[model samples]
Target: MNELAFTSWTESTWVGFDTETTGVNPNEDLLVTASLVLLAEGVKGDLSQVETANWLADPGVEIPEVAAQVHGISTEQARAEGRPLGEVCGEVAERIVDLWRSGAILVGFNLAYDIRILEHSLEVCGLTSLEERAGGYGPMVDPLVWDRKLEPYRRGRRNLETLCGVYEVSLDDRFHQADVDALATLGVLAAMVALYPSVRTLGREELTDYTAAAHQAWAEQFNRYLASQGRDANVEEYWP
Candidate 1:
């Protein structure tokens, strides 16, 4: 198969983003936690960067056990220490939009969910839409999508914890913290590029397009996978 020219994106700064929210539904749920790490200033031989900030928001609601279990932030802790929900979210959103405006690429594990959540927060805070402010921008890389496209036959869990093992990503701290998850996501992306040298062929913008399409293709591929496993194989959500 012919390869696409995708090189310009290679030199761009990649910002890692992650969030632990009150729940999954962007409309109803609140963004209780968020983090960002600049890949450009990462440590030697890895994409991990200095901890910029770990944001905790009050969410103005209870943090259910299920949500607390995932992120380790409790309602009591939040009430005592978390900044106002609007304030923390607003600052994160501003930094994100600023990063994009300055030409850095925002990379995340499941970027769509994180970005959508951030976008929702920005709208509520009366800030300009990130998409519009950045002129329809997207990430330099998205690890969850990248891994499925490049290593379709690989097995085992693809979640951050599993990838931490498969890719030798250090998860020294307990998992699910926003900063740790962002760092792990970057590690996964770095590992995928190393495993599949062909990915380097695409530049920044091309890489963005490739990842978006490849992720969708991977979803279709997984549906077939479900069929092979004799599962229901009847869902329609395919990583658009």
Candidate 2:
């Protein structure tokens, strides 16, 4: 099979994605909200050219207080205002698949977690997973993985807020809201590309492969560190 030709990062379309969930475990937690921001080529920062979608899911479970505090979505509010879990998951999955099929690269902060949570949500809702629908997860860009690999030595913390600070991306106090986070991820990516022009030169496939390998390398190193500390070393060595 001939591989599809891919444009450079600066010239490509990007779908910035994010999800706020009930908890951290993708396998068990439910998706409370999700956002997708589309940044078209040559108009990356222009609000008029950008397209956006946000979903609020009832999740069919009580929103934990801690999770509620993080994302500011309560179960009562969700029950009253959010759509059904299956309907929201199905629509989100379909939108993502359509964008991927149209050759838009997926962008996210820490994408693996969001992807896994969406995949699990689809399964729970009896809908097709994104992997199955999109054929594969690739042609994706994760700013978190890129930042860790690019600046491995200089880091106090690597969370989204910290990265936004490091990259000079403006993120207000509404950090955990899916839409805000997704947009911030896009800004951070732009900043990274500006600081590291070499990344913008790589083709889409090359960038995906590079980031995947970088993520696996980081996972392996971190797991070894955990083992050295006599803790369970269970970080999954995979990228979204």
Candidate 3:
């Protein structure tokens, strides 16, 4: 176990996770593409040396035009080339557990969405839940979650592309590709830790706890904002 309480964030193994899915609703969306990668930053997101796995699934449903527009994966393409969701989800869970068991922290943008949706997919395929498979989610480093905590006053949309620019990382044309998104999220994470001295000093487990609490605070504040706007607040209020 990495018992060190003050390891440099850039000096540790990070497992980046991302997915291109059928929609935004975790309870309803299907994962179309997913990527998991093991990397340590060499000046940031330089993925020249990395171990990675990616999966494309048929999802057993039509891809919505809007989603396909964003991700560039048509239902025709997925049906023609994708694997069964059963094999895909099982393999993904196994890889994730394998990486996390060895002490690699999970890193991503807004990762809870992908994870919860993946758990739903596993249920659809009768596979074990990721929580059950891994026992629990490990130490995590979510740039999206942390960014909200660190810079709540930062203006504009919080999309990956926008935040990537805010962090001075070049995302280019890879906005929706799962592998690219995962790697870019890793870069964003590296940048955030480098910028936030307070976070840089934390152990992975400590930071995970901190992010979880920050996420809950953000959710509650957002729900209050939504209520004031006279809309139903239905965001997921817990971590995956």
Candidate 4:
């Protein structure tokens, strides 16, 4: 493995990403939420200028109470303010694809969900898949996986909020919404990279590959923990 210095990554621009969904299955889940924030070097833009966006699209199904409780976007409100599902998903997919094409690294706390959902949305919109848009699936980063790999035995929750706290990054907005979550994810990612300078030298592809295996290991370990705690470990859902 390339033991690259992490400071080299500081020069790369990262697009912090997050999404809210009606459910967990990308193929069936409707994206009721989405956001992207640019995290460039030397200047962390105003949380306001972070280039954020959100949506409450009609899922064409009843909004589950548990999911609604997390995001507070209900079916009625979505119907009142939401655009057609195709339009909203298409717009989000196109915007991110354009960013990827422009060479910004896609960053997030748990980016797999966002990427998978975006790919599903693109398919639904008859646009190219995100993997295709990014030219053979590349240049993405996720701080959650980074943390797990860098400190496998460390304690405490691995959620974005928890990472923000560990990183001393402020959480200034609603937690589950896409906009704030994306920014928070970005902050956590920056802090992790700064803390682990070894990762700075990793090319985007290497970083993503490392994160993929680390995240899978984390999920397996977490499921065992949940089982020990007598909780139902829902494997199908993204570990949001």
TM-score for candidate 2: 0.92
Runs in model 3 lying further than 4 Å from the true structure = 1-10, 41-45
TM-score per candidate: 0.82, 0.92, 0.91, 0.82
lDDT of 4 by residue, 13-86 (tens): 67878888877776667677777777665123344455556665775667787888888888888888878777
lDDT per residue as tens, model 2, 1-240: 013222355657888999999999998999999999998872145434568899999999999999999999999999999999999999998998888777788898889899999999999988888888878766788889988888999849888888888878775548999988888888888777767756766876786798899999999999999999999999999876
Ranking 3 against 4 by TM-score, winner: 3
CA lDDT scores, all candidates in order:
0.72, 0.84, 0.81, 0.72
* lDDT for each residue of candidate 3 in 36-154, tens digit (9 for 90 to 100): 97886422435567788889999999999999999899999999999998888888889888877876778878888888889999998888899888787777777888889899998
Worst 10 residues of 4 by lDDT: 1-10
lDDT (10s digit) by residue, model 1, range 211-237? 778877766776898999999776444
As a TM-score, model 3 comes out at 0.91
Ranked by lDDT, the better of candidates 2 and 3 is 2
Evaluate residue 120 in candidate 3 and report its C-alpha lDDT on the 0 to 100 scale.
Answer: 92
Q: After superposing candidate 4 on the true structure, give the runs of residues whose Cα lies further than 4 Å from its correct spot.
A: 1-8, 42-49, 122-127, 217-240
- Which one wins on lDDT? 2
Residue 67's lDDT within candidate 2 is 96
Q: Give model 4 RMSD, 1 decimal.
A: 4.3
Please list the Cα RMSD from the true structure of every candidate, rounded to 1 decimal place: 4.3, 4.4, 3.3, 4.3
> Once superposed on the true structure, which residue ranges of model 2 sit more than 4 Å away at CA?
1-7, 42-44, 47-49
